[model samples]
Target: MKKILLGFIIMLSTLAYSQNELATSYAEKGRTLVMEKKYQEAVESFDKAIAINPKSALVFHHRGLAKANLKDDSGAILDYNVSIKLDDTDFEVFYNRGVSKYYLKDIESAIKDFDKSISLKSDFANSYLFRGYSYIELQKYSEAVKDLDKGLQLNPKSGSGYINRAIAHIMIGKNKEALDDADKSILYNPDDIRGYNIRGQAKAILEDYKSALEDFTEVINKKPDDAKAFFNRMAVRLNLEDKQGACSDYKMLKNLGEKPNSEMEEYCK
Candidate 1:
């Protein structure tokens, strides 16, 4: 009887080991698919892994990533919540959850998650960067500046970080700081037009009307249908006493189906 009982126990242990191995294989496949950007397929593979091993926190976290990439922020949050419940030790899980919450506009909740993530891993630059973004949404410019500064210090190549910090600086009336950050943003991401637009605004604030007009004109040169550039250039033209150019931009704004500002309409047309 003792021998038979031992054999049965060994059989059960072997079965459990095989099950775990299968689940791990599926989870690895899911991770590979995620890296391939085949998010839907990755989710399906994660589903199989989860069905086999519902206790795996990593699998749940990966599924949450797939869902987040799919733009299912609410669903991703649900998966992240499950992953956290399973094991709350992974800082990445909390950071990703915070990102999903940020996308959903749950700024306060996102900040809490980022705070937790930072507590777990203080050196993570993205946590500070995202926390800065959350603070910006709350219009806490000083707080945003502090967080963004830390993030940029940690990872200086982050173009989005520089641009966001520029916005905060502009809001705080630090036009020179804003201009410097905008320059950094352009240096990091020359293709992004927001940097040029922000630089133009900063120049206008600094009373460099010609330089500002050139920035706006550069944007229009790259993207002819950009109504934002046209509108800004129109204002700068007016500043430069080019009434005909301002009126021309006003017409282009109307052609693009953009609502010209009431004052601009009165001044130009």
Candidate 2:
């Protein structure tokens, strides 16, 4: 009887090890699918892994990532919650959860998650960026500036960070500071039209109509169908006393399916 019990115990141990190995294999395959952008397939693979090893935080985290890629932010949050419950030490999981919450428009909760992520990893620049964005959404421009400044300091080449910081500056009526950040954003990523748009807005606010017109025109040159660019250029032309050019731009904006505002209507008329 003792010999039989020993053999059975050995068999169970072997089976458990095999199951763990299988789970690990499935999890690895899920990660590969995620990398390929096959998010749905990756979730399926992760499902199989979870069935084999329900305790695996890594599998849950990868499944959350796959769900996030598919734009199922709530579902991703669920997986992230499970992963966090299993292992709260991973800064990545907290950051990703913050992103998922942001997509769900839960800005306050997202900020908390970002705060947790930053606390875990102080040098994580993206955490600061997202937290700053959440502050912007909350209309806390000063807080946004502080976080964005920290993020930019950590990653000077981040064009998105510069653009967002520029927006914060603009919100606070710091037009010159906004323009400087916009210039840095363009220097880092020339193809990003947002930089030009922000720069144009800043210049217009500063009463530099000619330079504003030039910046808006540059955006229009890159994106001809951009109604906002046309609208901005129209406003800049109005400031420059170019009534005809302003009317023409207003017409182009209308052609692009954007309704002219009341002021635009009066000006164009």
Candidate 3:
């Protein structure tokens, strides 16, 4: 009887271990899929993992990421809250939940989460960047610049930090500083089409139509199908009295069915 009981106990232990192993395997696969942008498949894998181990906080965190990628921010936040409940000290959970809250326009709650994340991981540059952006949205540009400066100190290679800092500068009428940061952003990421667009806007503000036109033309070259690029370039060309170029883009806009009104006729004429 003793030996029979011992054998049963070992069998149950092995089964339990097998279930945990399966759950971990599925969770890992789901995380990989999420990173690969195969978010729908990732959710399916996470569901299987959850079926095996419903109480896993890390699995919930990864599944939340997949849900957020699919634009299911509420679902993602629910999972993130569960994960935070299970492990409140997780910096990533706070940061990701903060992002979801920010998108949902819960700016105060998002700031609190970002604060938690930064408290947990002081060197988290991305958290600073996001927090700075939130501050900018709230019109606290000075505070935003402080956070962005810290982010730049922590991550010198971050082109987005430069771009956002440039925006803050522009908001405060620091045209020279804004121009410098915009140039740095382009230097860091030449292929970033938005960088050119923002730089062109800055040049336009400075009344440098020649340089503005060049920058906008580069943006259009990189992204031919971008409607904003065509629209912006047309405005700059109009300023320069480049009627031929402006009319050409108007025709392109017409072919794209972008303009519903007769404004193109008025502009081109």
TM-score of 3: 0.83
Ranking the candidates on lDDT from highest down gives 1, 2, 3
The local lDDT score (0 to 100) that residue 160 gets in candidate 1 is 93
lDDT of 2: 0.95
Q: What is the C-alpha RMSD of each candidate to the true structure, in Å?
A: 1.6, 1.6, 3.2
Residues 13-126 of candidate 2: C-alpha lDDT, one tens digit per residue: 999999999999999999999999999999999999999999999899999999999999999999999999999999999999999998899999999999999999999999
Give the number of colliding residue pairs in candidate 3.
0
Badly placed stretches (over 4 Å) of model 1 are 260-269
- What do the candidate models score in CA lDDT, each in turn? 0.95, 0.95, 0.89
Q: Is candidate 2 or candidate 3 better by TM-score?
A: 2
- Lowest-scoring 10 consecutive residues by lDDT in candidate 3? 259-268
Report lDDT (Cα) of residue 179, candidate 2.
98
Q: Residue 241 error for model 1, in Å?
A: 1.2
* Candidate 2 stretches greater than 4 Å from native: 260-269
TM-score of 2: 0.94
